[model samples]
Target: MEGKTCCVTGHRDLPQKEINHVKAALRREIDSAVADGFTRFMSGFADGVDQYFAEIVLEKKKTNPALELIAVIPYQKRLDSLMAKGRTYEMLEACADVVVMQEKCHPSVYSHRNRYMVEHSDRVIAVYDGREKGGTVRAIRFAHQFRKELREIPVGLILDKNRTNLGQNRI
Candidate 1:
């Protein structure tokens, strides 16, 4: 429930072809954060990359029992909104060490959730496609404004020379 916390944010509709590569990059970023003494990971419990990030945190806890997974649920009906995104809603709720529910749900509930996470976290690990809009873009911008250490994985250009395949996935 304490120590350095990293919040996760990303798009819901990630391209299928980049799933593996993006996940790899996210895992690496998370591992590096752990090495830097991040003991807790926070997720919005949304679809796509948020779910993936939460899964990685849970998996990492198997080896590092001290690590914690926290779900920052925005409003009471947040799960209902997230339910369409596979079993992430149930999984995160069941596995999270701490689940913080907001007072109410509003039209801008997700924005509130993102703000809460960014405000509390010391760092942010976001999978962004650089589309110039959407919640992912907003979260990344918010993180920068809050001066949180950000590790952004460009899932859009999953095949770009500089970012793709980690150390080496050359053609």
Candidate 2:
């Protein structure tokens, strides 16, 4: 899985209007990765982009048995929170492996999980706005340091599309 794995990182709270566009981009990127021989996809199991990645991978797994979804959970508390979401719980149930990085929550647990994912993955698919400084940014930086192949779906692209649509509506 070391050389054939792809990990995903992104913002947890996405603009509701951009969900479809983001999903489309994710599907395209995932398909491209499959074409490039990536079989295992890992997700941090966060709310927005991570959930979308897990759901897409699970859906693809139904048609392609070779594809695997690995859930890299940061801590026990975070896992509990995710389990409360029925969709995420179902996703977890369908995962090939669930790795709990920490038993208790720590300041560095999320970063640790991000590092672990990048370390094990050959590529990274990031849904970033290119401005916010958070876990997503840190994960992308790790990808660069580790020299992993990166495919970014910019949030700003979706925002620009919305603006264009708004402008056209006024015409």
Candidate 3:
């Protein structure tokens, strides 16, 4: 359709509660996207939030057949790190259109994957802790540089700095 396509990115390691928060935010984003006539989703298939996004899209596809879920994998060997590659394979086989960046694995493949996602998407939904480095930060930077609309769920913003419990108490 002539609507937006969104890509999902997030931290690789997160606490369970934060993961749930990210999922909740994603659900809201998906709902908003659907309302805005966006029916396509792209995910990089990373361990944490990416996988969650894909799974949610797959679930939504059951009722909304018009939705398209595309898995943009960094490399083929990324499957090795997956706890259950078969599940991912089956999901991709059943719901997603797979795009592999490189036939062989490389340390830099994830960057390629992030670029591909950003290039193909009109918007980015990021669950970021606002780290200065890492793939999520890099992807956000790319989105910013490309002038793509960014929907960021800042999970770590509050915990980033420890201040006084009361108003303006300094040691």
Best by TM-score: 2
Tell me each candidate's TM-score: 0.82, 0.89, 0.86
Candidate 1: lDDT of 135? 86
lDDT, candidates in the order shown: 0.80, 0.92, 0.81
Off by over 4 Å in 1: 80-86, 93-104, 157-171
Predicted candidate 1 versus true structure: per-residue lDDT over 1-171, tens digit per residue = 468988899888999988887788889988999999998888887768888888888888888888888888777666656655566756665564545456677778788789889988999988877777788888888898999999888766544645556557665
If candidate 3 were superposed on the true structure by all CA atoms, what would the RMSD be?
3.2
- Identify the runs in model 2 with alpha carbons over 4 angstroms from their true place: 157-171
Tell me each candidate's RMSD, in Å, in order: 4.1, 3.5, 3.2
Candidate 2 residue lDDT tens string, 1-171: 543999999998888987898999999999999999999999999889999999999999999999999999999998898889888889999999999999999999999999999989999999987655789999999999999998889886556876889999999
Candidate 2 or 1, higher lDDT: 2
Q: Candidate order by TM-score, highest to lowest?
A: 2, 3, 1
